[model samples]
Target: MKNFEIIANLLKEIWPEHHAKLTSEICQLSSDDAFLLDYIAEKIILIKKDKLKQAIKNYKQTCAVIVQEEIHFRRTQSYRLKTEQQADTEIYSNSSFMDMYLDGLLISQLFWSNHFKVFQFFCSSFLTQISKDDTLNRFVEIGPGHGLFLSEIVKKLPSRECLGYDISESSLRHTSQALQSLECAANVQLINKDIYNLPTDQNFDAIILSEVLEHLEAPQEILTKLSHHLTPKGLLFINVPVCSPAPDHIYLFKTPNEVQDMITSCGFRVNETRYFPMTGYSLERAIKSQATISVAAICQLST
Candidate 1:
């Protein structure tokens, strides 16, 4: 059986209630994305098979929590992410809690339709941009949680120098282990540093900031910093969720336009933008219902 099939069976056996919905989403995956998901499944089996069941449980529970939070958001029109200090104390500082959270998030990129589509957008749009630009050689991904984006970079653009930065040592370690399992860590450097501490003189030809903006207290500051670090002809791929409520998410983007405006105002000229509504919600319906929507944008520095 393919790794994805094996893991699907495992999820079915453990979470029968979610089987039909998950199977539907799996069937909707494109061939390339399905392959990428299989690759991730194979790595999980190799590295964390003993903990796979628990991870799936965590993912299911997290989904439930998000559903409730989304309900609250719909009622209040505000996200639960009130402050960074709360996130630091309640989510980031608790190692065991983060272990479960990260494990669930890794699975989310595979099964969550919006998350999967955002990754697909990154793979198609960002990679195509870099492949056509010979000058785009150096790559950096800020807050490369789970190492999926960096793995794609090192795999497709093998000659490109790559860097991954995270403020948490444990998060960096998790990302490193993920790359190591895929055997793509040979050319990728994982840095234990805050985004502000990144070397000012070092500019990169490509930068990826996926699902990171929502976690920050001031996302515009990081976006501005990224603009300064990008090469004159460099491209950036960034993903942020609108109306998404999570334990660690701080900044709340209320709509796709809001997300786009924030990026454009932060010294970027938007090259392309794709908005992916969560599964079972159409873009219009999501907007009308105030549902979560993932906004993926490809940008260049505004001259």
Candidate 2:
């Protein structure tokens, strides 16, 4: 409660126009769900309070860019991020920019309607369903930015060994700090490594790749590699945004079916799927208008 109050106050001060709406949306969350977000805010504030205001401002700027690009996409039916070179130049090499971007994203996970709802599906659906399996003892998350999913994995499956892989040391560091702040890093190993370089023989019972697909040039390759890394019966959770245009997003998925098709093509069978359209838009309206719609899928390797 205290942490939520402090962070909410900070957001209100930094972005007064959006704060009331954020508050209204947050009030709709179940008490337990609300507490989890508050707890996350506490850890983030403890870790980045010094730069929190700037991060909020950066998020505002990031949203502005996305809005402009989204308009262009709707008109042109093309994403501005067309090549790997652009992503490398604009996103991967810029350390300060990435820091601000990551900070804003962490806040978005808490306050953004679609993002929060997708995470809720992850918690109530995917995680809950997987928790039924007593044999699931090992877990890995690719690009676990902000450590929310990793921490939740540890909390839900305390006995499972957890691994988080990310190419950015700063991103991994933030995840580590977040886990430690939540006092759940004991079973987590944060590795500064890329998925392509991971040992071939290593496998996991569950793998999480959320919001990372949109950043890749060839998502199919990564998904294929992940399939190789998953045990035969392993479950994989993927979250991607369709018709979403962001500064760093490269791969453009046009529909939810495209996402599921990609999964199937990569050797995974879609077990369950959930869609969360952007706030203020219904699923049908979002699809018709080409608005951002998040697709969260739970999958397993095909026989």
Regions of model 1 farther than 4 Å from truth: 27-40, 43-47
Q: Please, what's the RMSD in Å of model 2?
A: 2.2
Q: Rate the local accuracy (lDDT) of all candidates.
A: 0.84, 0.85
- Which parts of model 2 have CA positions greater than 4 angstroms off? 23-36, 46-51
* Per-residue lDDT of model 2, residues 158-248, tens digit only: 8889999997777787788878877898989989887879999889999999999988889999999999999987899999999888878
Q: What TM-score would each prediction reach against the true structure?
A: 0.93, 0.90
